[model samples]
Every structure is written in structure tokens, then in C-alpha cells.
Target: MSRGAEARQGLTLIGPPLFYALIMLAAPLAMVVTFSFWTQDYLDIDTTLTLDNYREAFSQPIYRVLLLRSIVISLVVTVTTVILAFPMAYFLSFKVKRRKTLWLFLITIPFWTSYLLRVFLWKVILGYNGVLNSALQGVGIIDEPLTFILYNANAVVITLAHAWAPFAILPIFVAMEKIDRSLLEAAEDLGDGPVRRFFRVTLPLAMPGVMAATIIVLIPTVGDFITPKLVGGTDGLMIANMIQVQIGRANNAPLGATLAIISMVVVSLIAVGIYLAGRKFGGRVE
Candidate 1:
């Protein structure tokens, strides 16, 4: 193809999606930004430019606390999910010599159900009169039901980790599968132990998938409100829950917009930091 024709074809391929993003994503984000600088009256929106929303968001202790808690929870969930998934992914990639597709299908069985239903199932499993407590009682393991398992930050982390497991596994598995087996054999021949081989060879090669999985889980988990809402009681409430309150019953859209923007900024910074750190570590490995 000629240069001009190629250019036109490229534009043709990208133009529709770019325009859609402009309309659906950029435009809405712009509106939220604009709204954040405005104020809301009793039943009307005061479009006058002001910084009160941001000032309140930063000055308020609750917002800061919730934002920090959300970050912590997200980090915990990401680490837990990645740790748990690595073994499973490793098994599937290296050890599972037969019926790999069946195991993978089973791994995705949870996804066939609604996300809300999964949350509710966890709630049922963790609640005071839930399955776990009942099972414990039935087995005579405890005289009383365990109240510490549900409706808290721990629950949030566990739920999110479970929910995001597949996301973490798939990328890591892909990365591990793509690794040349000869490198591992060569490392073994060189008198490297299994642990050393993994650290110096397998782990480094799998970093790309691990990084992708981390980013995928971290971003969404930080902003998740549903799991927190269903399983997270007062102490477990996250920034997203507060934002939802502001936009919902609180009738303070401006404040909600401000909080949302702040969250986006914080998440963006974290994602960038993680990417840079991973890149540096990967460079060291190389």
C-alpha cells in the first residue's frame, strides 16, 4: 500500500474508537471535573466555580482515613491473590500433564455466577448463623460462632482476593508457559537448586505476567464498593462506599465528584509507581 493509503487506513481503524472514547470517557470525566469545582444547593446545582469541595475532601479526616484504608485493602488483596495464584498457575503450566482444559474450566466456574451472588454467598458463609459457624458448631470445634470472620477489612481482603484470583492466575500462567524450558534445564545442569532456578530464571521471566496481574487487580479492587458494601460493615467501609454515599443519599454530587477525582489521581500515581518499580526490577533481572 502507498504511504497515504496506509495512513488513511490507520485513521479509519482508530477513528471510531477514539471518537467513542472522547464521547463516553473524556466527556464524562470533563463533566465530573467541572462539577467538582462547583457547589450544590438544597435542590439545585450552583455552577459557580469554587474549591470548597476539594478543600473539604482534603481537610476532612474521614476522607483521608478511608482513602488510606482503601489503599491498604487493595494492596493486601493484590498480594494475597498473587501469592495464592502463583502456585496454581505454576502447577497448571508445568505439572498438569493431562486434562488442563478441565481444570481451567473448573477454575472459571465461579465466574458463571453473578458477581453480586458471589458476594452474597460469602456473606452467607461468613455471617453469624452462616455455613462456617454452623460447620464449626457441628464439628464441636467451637462453643460459639466466630464473629471475627465477616463484616470487616479481613473479609474485604478475602473476598476481593478470591474474586480476583482468576485474573491474577491467567497472566502469570501465560508468562510461565511462554518461558523456554531449556533455561530451567540449563540452570539445573549448572548446579542451581530449585529455589535458585525459580528466583534467577523462572520468576524473572514471569515478571511481565505478574506485573500485568498486579495492575489488573490493584486498580479495580481499590475502587470496589460492592464487596465493601455487602461484607464490609462500618469498620470496613472504603473510599468508594463514602463516595457512593455522597452521590446517593447524601445529595452532594460535587463532593462525590471531588472525591472521585482525588481517587483517580491517587490510583493513577500508585499504578505508575508500581509500573516503574516493576520495570526497574525486571531490568535488574535482565
Candidate 2:
């Protein structure tokens, strides 16, 4: 095939997928936007254009609390994951000499089980009659089970952080691996120490991955209901759970749609902002 023909062929192949994605995506978002502005008739939508849903969403103090709490938890999870993943990624990229695939597989082994099972596993480990308590008692370190370990904010953070650790690590590892080894060698030749070389050379180049990992981990968990519902009690209920309640229990479609739209909008904004932020994080020319 000629060059022009190949170009045309590739475009033809790509166009359909893009078109399909837009149709599938555009319709739902339009519906959400429409619903958010319409009035709620008790539990059903009246579908007439009005600002009740948005006004209701903004006017309520409870919704604001939930929104703020979700953001805070997401931020904590993002920060903690970044810190933990950085060292692991650094070791994986710079230190480990054997079984890279094996190590990666081990990291992903947690995925073999269902996510619900994973949350329950944490519950078991942190429960009063659970493994950690058993170990502590066995070792005579404590005479009683700790009340603060499970069904609290800290437990929520700890569980989400553990669940999201791999999300941060893999991206960072990929970013680190993408760096040219010659740059590091050149830095060392100029008398740059390990610490200097990392901050000056490695960190900057690896920043995109770090940002990607943060976004990847933080976004889903921000809207996550399962982990919080299963592991967290009253304190851990996020905006998603509230959305769920409105839709499931209250049978409030219009309000649920409004909440869903608001959540989606915020999540989309944060995701784009983070992705752009990731792309420009280190201010790297490339």
C-alpha cells in the first residue's frame, strides 16, 4: 500500500471506535446534566427544567460534609500511597537484580481474590477476635483487643492505602524504567551523589508516573462504596454511599441523579486536573 492509502486506512479504523465511544459516553452525561437541573417529585423526576437538584445539593450542609470528607480521604490515600510506593518503586527499579517479574507478580497476587474478600480479610485481621489481636495476645503485647483498629477513619485510610498501593507503584516503576540509564551515569561522573542524582535527575523524569499513580489510585477510591461499607461504619460513609442510599433505599431518582452528576463532575474535574498536573508536574521539557 502507498503511504497515503495506509494513513487513510488507519484513520478509517480509528474513526469508528472514537465515534462509538462518544455516543456511548455522550448520551449518559447529557441525561445526568438534564436531570441535575430538573425537579424531584418525591422519589421520581418530574423532568421539567429547574435548578432544584443543584440548589438542593449546594444548600445542604450534610452533602458538603460528605463531599469534604471524601476529598480528604482521597488526599490522604493519595499521599500515603505515594510515600509507600516511591520507596518500593525505587528499590524495584534501582536495587533489585533478580526476579523482577516474580516481584511484580507477588505485588499483584492480591488481585487474585475478589475485592470484597480483600476488605473482609482486613476486617478479619483487624477485628477484635482477628489475627492481629491474636498475634498480640499470643506475644503478650496486649491483654485486650484494640477498639481503635477497625470500623474507624484510620482503618478506612489504612485499608484503602493498602488496596491502592499497587496502583501507585506500577506507574512509578514504569516511569523510572523509562528513564535513560546514561543520564544517571553522566550525573555520577559529574560527582553527583545518589541523593542528588535522584532528586535532580530521577525524580523529575519519574514525576509523570508518580502523578499518574496518584490519580489512578485516588479517583476510584474517591467514589468507592464497597470498602467503606464493608470496613467502615458511620464515620466512613462517603458521598457514594449517600448516592447509593438515595437511589436504592429512598428511591429518589432525581436526587440520586443529581448527586451522581455532581460526583461525576467533581471526579472528572479532579481527574483532568490531576492528569494535566501529572503531565506538567516536574516541569520537564519533554
Candidate 3:
């Protein structure tokens, strides 16, 4: 094709996506920025502007702690999911050839159900007299129920990790599967063992996928209110949960809007940092 033809084709393809992104994302985000500056009284927002919402957020130690804790929990979940997904992705991509589709399908099967239902199911399983306790008792693993399991940090982590597992696995698996088998055979022929080849070749090639998965899982984990409210109790509450309380119970719309904006900024910064870091690391790989 001529250069002019190619240019026209590219524009035609990109125009729709640009329009969609602006309408779907940019417009709503612009509204949030507008709302953040205005004060809401009851259902109506006043036209006046104020910075008290931000000042209040900074003044409250609990809000600051919640923000910090959300970041920490999201980071932990991102790291843990990557570690756990790596081996599974490797198995699907390099080792298991016969049932690859079946395995991938199963990994993503839980997502076919409702997201809220999954959160509620975790609550049921982790409750004091829930399935875990019953199973443990039946098997004589523990004589009594563990109340902490249902409403704590551990429960949130466990449940969110499970919820986010497929997101990490699929991307990593796709990256690993893209690697040519001849590359592995070439490494083996050079007397490189499995571990050496992985570090030198497989891991480097898969870094982009790992980075993609990390960003995906971490963003949702940070903004998740359902997991925190259902599983994480008073001690395990995240920033999102606090924002919910501010808007719902405290009747503090400005504070909630401010917190949401800050949370968005923090998560965006983290994601950008990860993306840049991933690009740098991927460049170093091969």
C-alpha cells in the first residue's frame, strides 16, 4: 500500500477508539474534578469552592492510615499474585501441552459468576461458623471456630487474591506461550539448566506480562470496597471503605469526593511508575 493509504487506514482505525475513550473516561473524570471543588449540602451542591475537604483528609490520622494501608495491601496483593501466577503460567505455557485450554478455562471460570457474589461467598466461607471451621473441625484440624478469619486483613487478602488470580495468570501465560520452544531447546543445548534458562530467557520475556498483571490487580485491589466491607473489619478497612463511610454514613460528600480524587491520583501515579519500570526492565531482559 502507498504511505498515504496506510496513513488514512491508521486514522480510520484509531478515530473510533479515541472518541470512545474521551466520551467514556475523559468526560466522567472531568465531572469528578468539577464536583471535587464544589460543596454538597444534602442532595444539592453549592456553587462555592473550598479546600476544606482536602484539609480534613490530611488532618485525620485515620484517613491517612487508611490511605497508606490501602497502598500497602495493594502492593502486597500485586506481589503475591505475581509469585503465585508465575509457576502456573509456566506450567500452562511451557510444561502442560495437552490440557492447556482446559486449564485456562478453569482459571477464568470463577469470573463467569457475579463479582459481588464471589465477595459474599468468601464471607460465608470465612465466617466464624462457616465452611472453613466446619471442615477443619470435621477433620480435627481445629476444635473451635476462628472469628478473626471472617473480618480481618487476612480474609480480605485471601479473598481478593482469589478474585484477582485469573487476571494475573492469563496475561503471564500469554507472554510465556509466545516464547519459541526452539529458544528453550537452544538454551538446553548450550548446557543451561531449567533454572538458568528461565532467568535468562523465559523470565525476561514474561516481565511485560507480569507488569501488566501487577497493574491490573493492584488498581482494583486499592479501590475495592466490597472486599473490605464484607471481609475486612474495622481493623482491615481500606481507603475505599472509608470513602464509602464518608459519603454514606458521615454525610460528608466533599470529604468523600476529595478522598476519591486523591486515591485516583495515588493509584495513577503507582500505575505509571510500574509501567515505566516495566518498560525499563523489559528493555534490559533481551
- Candidate 1 global TM-score: 0.95
Count of steric clashes across candidates, in order: 0, 0, 0
Query: What would the TM-score be for candidate 2 when compared with the true structure?
Result: 0.90
Q: Predictions ranked by lDDT, top down?
A: 1, 3, 2
TM-score order, best first, reads 1, 2, 3
Which of candidates 1 and 3 is the stronger one according to TM-score?
Answer: 1
For lDDT, the strongest prediction is 1
At residue 148, what lDDT does model 2 achieve?
Answer: 87
What are the per-residue Cα lDDT tens digits for candidate 2 across 1-286? 9999999999999999988987999887787677667766565567678877788889999988888788888889889989999999989998998999998998998888887888989999999899999999999999999878788767788899998898899999999989999999999999999999989999989998888888888788888888888878888878888888977888776677888778777877887787777567586423
**Predicted structure with the largest TM-score when compared to the true one:** 1
- TM-scores for every predicted model: 0.95, 0.90, 0.90
Worst 10-residue lDDT window for candidate 2 reads: 277-286
- Which pairs of residues collide in model 2? none
Better of 1 and 2 by lDDT: 1
Model 2 misses residue 120 by how many Å?
A: 0.8
Q: What C-alpha lDDT does candidate 3 achieve relative to the native structure?
A: 0.87
User: In order, what lDDT does every prediction score?
Assistant: 0.92, 0.85, 0.87
Check candidate 3 and list the clashing pairs.
Answer: none
Name model 2 segments beyond 4 Å from true.
1-11, 42-44, 272-281
